[model samples]
Target: MAIHRKRFRVEEAIVGEMPSPEMIEEAAPMHSEIMAELRAIRAQMAKGTPPAPLSGSAAMAAIDASTAHELSEARTMLETYRAQIEQCEKLKVELDLIHDAIDRTKREIATLHGKSFDGGEMAKVNGELGAVVGGTEQATQQILEAAESIDQAASAMSKVQSADQQKRLADDIQERVISIFEACNFQDLTGQRISKVMGTMKFIEQHINAMMEIWGGVDAIKAHVPAHVDTRSEDDKLLNGPKLAGDVGHASQDDIDALFD
Candidate 1:
């Protein structure tokens, strides 16, 4: 037995230690005091009782309220700024449309004036004329939309009932009209053609001015006219006379003789 005996060692399991009574007693007062204060505050809030005022606390609260008000005002200002930007974007689109319409009209007029009697020249001119007319028609529709937008914006500005607003609107309209007039001046149409178009435009302008004077401006005239009235026929008649005469008179006599001979 002394020679063959084997010793077996048993290991004890370790257990977690609990906190001491003194430590628990020390922590208990701090926990209860915190809980009591929290309950008191909750009760006061529930009862709608105002908190005990502190020195400088009133000023701080007022400052917080003022900050909140300022923030609200800033938000409102940002919204207004966004709306203004949107309105400006819309106006820009309308302005571009008007410019495009004027360009198309000018191109069409140029094409019509450049037409020749030669078959090849006539064919080329006709194709150009067709394209010009198509562009003009599309541009005209866009211009009409832009005009409507202008009218609406003008009306809205007028309704502001402010002298500054009215003056601004008037100035804007005048500027736009002047720009249109300047654009309409035909630099390409020189010599007889330019003279004729200028004369025609002047005549039209005078007539329109006279009408405005007599009828108390465009609005009055438009109001007096029947809704179904077709004014384009009269306008076309006025436009065509000078244009036709100028074109005929400008024809080369030598070219005519060569064709006949």
Candidate 2:
């Protein structure tokens, strides 16, 4: 079937004024991306075969179908955008939590630095520990000297036959024993100094534990702990110092002596 074509010249009428140049300039940037996409669509339409003319009812039906298809695509795109927005919101919340955690940790670390390092608490601890060591060394030396004197006097007494010489040796032994008793006073001083150090250490530990809690807890901290490496030389490694009271897994003095035996 052939379709009749008609041509007519239409007079131009002023229906409305064009938007101001300022408004056009403002909207141009906003719609640039949309304009680009529309141009692409127009190019594709120009390349495709044209559809045959339709009767009134058929054209209406075709229009309805096209509208429904476009609506479906728009709905799908809206749903995708909504899912993306929800995901972005969730990620933002997670980031906020992480930021809060970092801030808390930073605050705790600063506080720890101020209290332990800047406030001289650590210096006080070191001074107290050093004094304890110095006192212990001096006391040990005094005790050793007194023991040597007592041992000499006793040995001399065993050999002496005269009552005057034996009596003199006994008197010397008594004086040495008194010196040994006096040297033992370092233990009391050491205990007091150690107590002060322990108090400072406890304060630092509390802050560290608070930071651990901010992240998670001990288990979380353990996950980040690096592998242990004994970096000390063999001799330094053996010098673990005196074990703390109630500490297990360390060799006792007897165990060490038995090695030689």
Candidate 3:
């Protein structure tokens, strides 16, 4: 009988160890509460809520601190990116100014050459004028080369993925422009010619400002103008009358009479 009783007790212990549906149902609410608390903690963290005092090991605190540091670093990186983009935009404006200066120099050189040639004193002033022309031509070439370098640098800076590269290019372009302006000798001329060149440069500056106001920058102007359209108009074409009027296909006696009258 005692043996049978022990056997019965052993059977009861085994049955208790096996999982039961009732027991699982009884523990479901506790499991759900734990999950809800975890989700709430995550939500608070996402909303930038301050952390509560924790009883766990230092590992969790270290992870949290590292995550915050990374976030701060990311924000700094983004600010740096925005600053670089702004600097590039500013550099573009400077590059446009340089291009305008180069164009103005070219026009002034052309005007000076025209005036010197048309003055009709070539016999007396040929040597002096020739030297001036040579110097002007050299300066013009240098200005154009520098302008091209600036334009290319601006373009490269715009395309660059690195902020440091953009900064370096911008600095280089600025330095080149300054160097060109300093190296140019505009002091040899004695009177109205120098004044006229200065006037031209001023006019160029005004024109560039107007263009920037209308279109934003050099790139914007390029975007607006069709690439295939020739900007230069021939002198002969400007002087020529309309071909249709000169064709003699549709004239009347009344027109002749009116002209005579």
- Candidate topping TM-score: 2
Q: Residue 220 deviation, candidate 3, in Å?
A: 62
Which candidate's lDDT is highest? 2
- The C-alpha lDDT values of all candidates are 0.63, 0.88, 0.70
In the range 38-130, model 1's lDDT, one tens digit per residue, is 999999899998966766988799899999999999999999999999999999998997787566655544544444334665465455556
**Best to worst by TM-score, what's the order?**
2, 1, 3
Task: Give candidate 3's TM-score.
Answer: 0.26
Give the Å error, residue 69, model 3.
Answer: 99
Task: State the TM-score for model 2.
Answer: 0.68
Residue-by-residue lDDT tens digits, candidate 3, 147-168: 8899999889889999899889
Where does candidate 2 clash, by residue pair? none
Q: What lDDT is reached at residue 236 by model 1?
A: 66
Q: Indicate the residue-level lDDT of 142 in model 2.
A: 97
Worst 10 residues of 2 by lDDT: 4-13
Ranking by lDDT: 2, 3, 1
Off by over 4 Å in 2: 1-50, 156-171, 229-261
Query: Residue by residue across 1-261, what tens digits does model 2's lDDT show?
Result: 334333233312343445545667778876998999999979978999567779999999999999999999999999999999999999999999999999999998898788887747777888999999999999999999999999999999999899999999999999999999999999999999999988878888998899899889999999999999988897786777789999775789999899999
C-alpha RMSD for every candidate: 34.4, 16.3, 33.8
